[model samples]
Target: MNRTFKVALAAGAATVALAACTNSSTDGTPTPATNGVASQTKSSSTTSGKPSNGDDLNISRFADKPCDLIKPDQLTALGNFRPGESSSAPLGPGCSWFGVDALKDTTFFVTLVTKGDNLESMAENAKSFPIFKRTTIAGREAYSADRTDGKASCSTAVSTSAKDAIFVQGRPPANGTGTADKSCQASEKVAAIVIGNLKG
Candidate 1:
């Protein structure tokens, strides 16, 4: 079931040269690799907050190394995992992290929105998702959304600036279990970790 979901996502990734992402490898649990980007360590400030909406982080650099967004300690704390498994969608370059027990643990993603789709635009497409409502992570404004009810996959899209944003998505184990709240929580956790790594 998990492999099927990732394949579907990866299929979209192949539509364009830039869209290189999905959640995991379709073959099986992969040997953790970062596609040549340097390995990342967690920052001390994974907490969230922004004094003003204009105060956004410059996240464009991570497009080439999306896996660096995840703090190593925080990621490993979830389970024996590393953020890599690169693939992409029209949204942007993405790196995925799947728990060692792929079928039983959670799946995570961090995608840099290189395109023009930011939080404001996401609101325009709110009707497309069952849960596209406002929220905050790491002190920045965002929206938590899912096509379904987040029973499996959920994401938090954070506005980094007027021009770009970052998307952090999480999925429960492929066993077809997990509630909407739990899935969204996973997304929120990953988003905070990414925001903490951003400078400027």
Candidate 2:
């Protein structure tokens, strides 16, 4: 369910990075850890892993290189995506899209878009989804989204800690139609792998 995210072209794209204080960790929960680059605090004080070269986590990898962690068979690329300073990766399908925004050295923002019959209609259609259950990793917060209408559907997820955050999203299609579901699901899973494989 992969598609190019056209939302990047829209003006005033909302910045959804979890690092911002304004965006509460999906659950409104708090962690007692200092925010530092490459440093992270798990929910239980467990060592998730270390970044490579004993250096702080650098999000530049994803920005600089397009790693195809998502298998071609698992999902087809609707097209190529070029992330901007404000928007990390913007890719879309015929009528759906996904992207992210980096909040800091360790945090990246995210967004998901579905084709709307019109601008106002799209906003209204997006309201049907509910915030997912929050999962805290290394004392950070995370969550996903699932929404639908008679003609379109979309979902998204965000993982965050004191040090960094990852955002993933998808939009299959209306009535379980397009690749949005698979894209959203695979993107979130790949995001976890990226975070889990961090070297710091």
Candidate 3:
């Protein structure tokens, strides 16, 4: 299997572990009303002052359509990139865009995982990187890390809810010329776009 695939599988496993350990329920089983009345059905709509736990809008909804998260105009603005393949794996669903330039080429991917609380998971994983930085994207907390592979790779984890997040990873194009920071910036930009779509 591909190294990327293996990494994704590992992520998926971690996600499952975290989710199983977290309390995702907002309320327990409904109770009967007085006077032998039935309890009112609770609305699924998000309530004000309540933090999202990803229960209202789960990542599984996009498990098979990750490519739809990005718009065509957004892709054009990013780099006139060609649409790459989409995949559904243990880590969730993801899509990649490929861009080629005279001097550098780039590949950017976006993935969503619903099984875990990425905010906490990123905290632990960031310790392994020398360039991990906390930031915000789309008004949500996020973490950016420079991959050990040097300037060729970058990744960002943006929290979608208390229990889920979307991960964006980018790599310099084959034989391409670009710095690690540039790759990371590109990944962040793509992540913001994807998050914007999700929020809307």
User: What would the TM-scores of all predictions be?
Assistant: 0.71, 0.35, 0.67
Q: Which ten residues in a row have the lowest lDDT in candidate 1?
A: 32-41
lDDT (Cα, tens digit) per residue for candidate 3, span 18-37:
33233334663222222111
Q: Candidate 3 has which clashing residue pairs, if any?
A: 105-173
lDDT digits (tens) for residues 74-190 of candidate 2: 223432233323343222111112332211111122322111111122122233344233344333334434333212222333333223344443433223344434544544554
How much does each candidate deviate from the true structure in C-alpha RMSD? 11.4, 13.5, 12.5
Q: Model 2, 92: alpha-carbon shift in Å?
A: 17
Of the two candidates 1 and 2, the one with more favorable TM-score, higher being better, is: 1
lDDT of 2: 0.30
Query: What C-alpha root-mean-square deviation, in Å, does candidate 1 show against the real structure?
Result: 11.4
Residue pairs in candidate 1 whose N, alpha carbon or C atoms collide under 3 angstroms = 19-88, 20-87, 20-88, 21-87, 21-88, 48-138, 48-139, 49-138, 49-139
Model 1 lDDT at residue 86: 74
> Per-residue alpha-carbon lDDT of model 1 for 1-200, expressed as tens digits?
35675675444334322322221445422111121111111111211222336676888777777877776787777666534687665667878776655677786767787654555554444434666678888777788876666787777777787666787767678675798888888888888878888853
Question: Arrange candidates by TM-score, highest first: which order?
Answer: 1, 3, 2
